[model samples]
Target: MKVDNSAIHHSPVAVSGGTLLAALAVAIFSFTFPATHWALGGFGPWTTVTVRAALAAAIAGPCLLAARAPLPDRRQWPAIAVVASGVVLGYPLLTTLALQTTSTSHAAVVVGALPLATAAIASVVTHTRHPRLFWIAACSGTVVVIVFALSQSHGAPTGGDLLLFASLLICAAGYVAGGRLARTMPGWQVIGWALVAALPLTGPAAALALGVEPSRPGGLSVLGLVYLAAVSQFGGLMVWYRGMAAIGVARASQLQLAQPLLTLVWSALLLGERLGAATPLTAVAVLVCVAVTQRV
Candidate 1:
């Protein structure tokens, strides 16, 4: 179907607006890990991942039709598939499985390194060359996170910790892919089409899962699943991809530095988890080191 590209055409969004929307996206995303932790008690991890994507695609589908948004160009399909692989399936599935064993508080601390991961991946995906110092900074951030993980002294890297680390790698790739696509396409379309592309797989998976759900789930678990589908998987991402495009991936991503702290706060308040006194210090150190990766 043809589109009046103008229907979804976004002019150059102001940096201030982009930053605010990015912050909003981050605020919404801060709920993801804790909510997933809660939802897992009710749903299988794979069920949660696939169903969330399918439900989100169901919402994005009608909106695309209503907007008359054209499908992304042929060449863009590959990138979109890669994005779907990571954001739609990889990150959600891995993190959900990880949280099945890891505390929300621990997940928050481990994910504190996401900004650095994004920065490093953005550089490669966008084909920008960073100075040697940037690598040094990236390594510094990695070291800080590793040391913090060790200090937490789980006595060997738990399976959950490894899953979270893998999730970071997949998510970083998705972020860079989304950011690159956003430069030419509207941000919303990037996520919209990714959801669409994932539908054939996730849609059926979700349908099958519905047949297997336990008769009754907690009220909060039901709410958590809805939030994951509506906000985390779909709506907030429309804002996030746009902001990443508008502000440039490098600068716009700096906002994620606050995500860990906010997530820690949410985990405590929502899940009644206790934060280590060292949590703030670890988050700050990771952020500072990650901040260095953006430097040329």
Candidate 2:
């Protein structure tokens, strides 16, 4: 039997490319919290969430039509709805609400557990078992996040913390579902269709929100809202799902461990949110866990 050197050589290249794409997505998402904070400076939370989804749908719908993208299979609609609800509606709304009470840095640290949640959910959804070491590292990371959250709230979980936790779980489900769907369809199409599917709900909701919410919409806030719509909602997920499809979802999710740290930096630079001593410490600890899981 001949061992194929070509396959051996190709595998690492593929993984590297996938890892790069996932890392890029993480970088894009890191700005989201600060952006949301900026948007909230001018718009109410409801208005911010609904308007971003509506704007993203506007962009994605036209792109799909221009590309002559085929409709998803009837079976896939349910999964697409999950994507829409989780990332498009649930996560953004919940996180924006949470950011109302919490600083962007605090929210970023609390969300550091997102990768662990995503990996756990991906395991169940894909029915793939990782090694014990992987779970240990992931759990360790979650523990760090939980401890930080508790300490920040003086041993009680604030409403913001609870909301962030809920957003984490739902967003993980969305990530896994979108990743699986990406295996069958183009990653861009998966998110594009999900945005279009969400339009029915988000369109009306945006209209109502704008009417009720009284937005000031300053220059920075408008730019922030546009970023949420164009990049965070649409462009980031396109590469993220593609990376998840290329790599396994579990592995790709581990890459997100870097997100909170990146977000911490953005919080300081963009939002001017002061980070305490524990924030960087917790972030580094989580990154250590990320390294362990990736190696395992």
Candidate 3:
């Protein structure tokens, strides 16, 4: 089978489009966590996840075939499985569970921790060397996020707080492993096989979820679910993995810090959520800190 090496290697347009698409994907993904939380006012966490993943698989499957993306080899399967479990399934599930009670703003802050978490985990497992500035930036970003989160504590259990934290940890692991796989496979192929690997779980999870009476999802709610599945999971991931392949995982992770701000925009538009007086100032600080890491 002939692969499109040109698309993979030499196309500047593909690379630029991939990067933009990845950013858009993250933006759309940020919306879904909050939207899913809203939807869960009507659906179970497992149900929301199952439906979302099913939609993503449906969209991604045909695209993978058209692209002639290769299936995972024996050696590649382990890494693929790791990402499937950690990212495709674990991240969404945790986020879904977390959003049930946590505010979207809080969820966004927790999700922002992803870049820092990715840096820490990758340093430990991959023998990758990053400059001191990177560590400083990563730690600074974490502190900024935590300060904002604790300052606004609602003094109640929103399942989202803990779940989002767990999701970030798992997602960081997936990013590190997925980067290694992307070195050998096309970005789309890594996601395609990993999605397949995750099917055994996603399939059963969706089926069990189907047993419930789906709440009357509004037009916006339905649209949000579809966006999460098709855009974020399928399209966004394709571009993100490509970015991961282009720049190493640790470097590519800098993109994630943008997620919180982007998400705040979506929340304001959709849910009438406003940024706190300090939100913007703190966001700038976080961005600067994350930018410092990119210099590393």
Candidate 4:
């Protein structure tokens, strides 16, 4: 479902706050792949995915109840399912699998096309037309990501590449659907509701994982898992949905062009990936395209 563009128009201050929230959310999200990379040393991808979701649901459900949030109406259920599946399930499951083989640096660049994917999702959902400049800018940013991958991997594609791309695509779909839902309810509440909706699946899976997996992972690995569940799965989406709701999907998603750059920094610091001189320049160019797209 798409929100009417006219309905989402907000005051300047609101939009600015949304932008800042989006930035904060992206910062939190950028840690996920790197954290997963480390956590995989101790936990299986399925284990990580299920356990994190279940933990998130624990927090989300209680918060929703405490706030006295209204349950979504019948019409909203389908959209909530899409939001829950894509963001809460699909993205984490795929990326956690991918990171077992892929470096965080590689994951960051491949997932860099998120803004373009988001715009494409938005176009389909809203059935809205953009100017010629917007299309050019959107495609240009994607091209830069492709070129970056080639330069990094010596033009070779890996299984992880496909998985991460799929993750980004699913995430873009969730972003669009969640953005639409956020217009009707509080943005944060959409994620909380989605988390609760996921409990039947996640809760059982998490219990099974805990039963089989070793209880004593290293401190860093434990920290990574907690971060993924608490911040990446729950907290980040709260702000991201609000931002998208405030600024409209097309414009706010463009802000995601900045995510990969932040992710790269995380990768370098946490995963020991080299932040080569070439990377920053390419990031700047892609961001310019994002800026242009937002304007057009």
Candidate 5:
């Protein structure tokens, strides 16, 4: 309920603790892909994303109501709406679609490049200058990841892969812009509003899922979906916002460098996909690049 902003600001220890917690949250968020893939094996991609969004909104929605948070200001609404599109709608939709065609490990590798994409957007939109090493890292990391991803591709390009990459770009923009906007509102409040705003769009899609004869998923699939909706989306957002608040967006985005490795680990565990020794090594290279890029 009541956050003591002053207390958190005064204490480096608190900030460090918060950042650590958020890093773990991002790690948890990465596993959602394999979980999603498992779920989609039963439910279609569209249905899975829609239901997840709907459930996330359901969980966070009541908290906003209980706290008596008011509607965002007119200026805030536009930004909130854009973020809602990306987080609530775009990211999930693209990721879900991508998983249908690719393994979760492969998808995680692609998404790992998101920090670089976010940095690129920051340069364009925010005019933030980054170090050359950062670009080197980003470019190198991304190239390797893409190469690996391509190797894993069973055949020629499906429209699905392109769509997934497009979604990544859109979501990257959302991450950059949303981080800025979240500065103005409470982190939870911002996410809560975005979730509600995206409901209308997600609602009809979810309805269509039920209309189709639903394929029955095993317990693992259901568990993964529930974890994705509740923990990854809902719980992850809470910590993410706090971290973003404690340290500005630029610094906060750096945490994403670790996400790909975490996802890779989860992929190995859940999907029985192996990244071998190359995975962690590649992730370290990417992380270094991301760190360099974020420097002032």
Candidate 6:
């Protein structure tokens, strides 16, 4: 009897490719808070969120059209709506608002719990169980992040912290839905359709915000706005959903444990935020947990 061994050979390659894609997505997302800070230098929170979504929709719309992508079936619309509400609208609005009140570094640390939230939500939505070790590692990372957040905030949850937490839940839900949908369709299409679905709301909101909000529109701010729309909103998620589909959602989410650390670096470099001594310690702890979760 001849043994195929083809799947055995390909499994590692597939996993490696997925990990790389997810890590790249994390790299792209790590710039988001800093970019939002720059965007806010010119645009109000409402304008920043609405305009970014609208711009992303504008970009995605043309790509979908050019690709001749068929419209998603009626059954898919509900999931797409969830994706639009959670990621396209809710997450950006909440995070942008939170950034108004909090320093970018503080907000970035607080959002470190996102990986745990994503994994937990993915478990529920995908009806999959992770090993006890996986949960242990994930929980450890979350606890470290929470402690750092508390220390940074002087032991109280500020309004910004609350908003960031809310964003976490909604974004996780959107991620799980998008990941699930990616199994059936192209990952890019998942986000493309979600962006297009959000056009009705985002388009009007953008117009209203531009009129109501004071806009400065410096070179850096304009660059930031464009990055948020083009990369953070559309490009990053395109690969992220693909990675989630390749790896299980729970596994893919654990990769984001490094995102906050990356964000911290960006904050310091881009916004001139000073890092506290605790940051290094927190980075080590988070990385350890990330490694364990990936291994287990």
Q: Report per-prediction Cα RMSD to one decimal.
A: 5.0, 3.5, 4.7, 2.5, 4.4, 4.0
Candidate 1's TM-score reads 0.92
What lDDT tens digits, residue by residue, belong to model 6 across residues 1-296? 22112123337778688778888999999999999999999989999999999999999999999999999999898889989989999999999999998988778777777776776776676566667997898889878877877777789878888899899899988988898888778889999999999999999999999999999999999999999999999999999988877775766777887888888989888789988888767876877776776676
Residue range with the least summed lDDT across 10 consecutive positions in model 1: 1-10
TM values, all candidates: 0.92, 0.93, 0.85, 0.91, 0.88, 0.91
* Tens digits of lDDT, candidate 4, 1-296: 33347225588888888888888888888788888876777777778899889999999999998999988999999999999999999999998888888777767767777777887778878886778997998888888877776676678757777788788789888888999999999888999999899999999988898788765578887889998889988999999898878877776776777788888888887778877776777777777877887676
Q: Give the range of the ten consecutive residues with the poorest summed lDDT in model 4.
A: 1-10
lDDT of each: 0.83, 0.87, 0.72, 0.83, 0.74, 0.85
Write candidate 5's Cα lDDT for 40-134 as tens digits.
86777777888888888898889998999988898898878877888778888888887777767667766777777877876777665655676
What's the TM for model 2? 0.93
lDDT of 2 by residue, 1-296 (tens): 22112113337778788778888999999999989998999999999999999999999999999999999989999999999989999999999999999999998888888877877787777666678998999889888988999999899999999999999999989987898888889888999999999999999999999999988989989989999999999999989988877776767777887888899999888777788999999888988886787666
Error of 5 at 196 (Å): 0.2
Off by over 4 Å in 4: 1-8, 150-154, 212-216
- Pitting candidate 2 against candidate 3, the one with the higher lDDT is 2
Off by over 4 Å in 3: 1-18, 66-68, 154-159
Query: Top model by TM-score, which number?
Result: 2
lDDT of 1 by residue, 225-281 (tens): 889999999888899998887777777678888888899889888788878777778
Clashing pairs in 2: none
* Clashes (candidate 5): 0
Model 1 scores a C-alpha lDDT of: 0.83
Which of candidates 3 and 6 is the stronger one according to TM-score? Answer: 6
- The whole-model C-alpha lDDT of candidate 6 against the native structure comes to 0.85
Q: What residue pairs clash in candidate 6, if any at all?
A: none
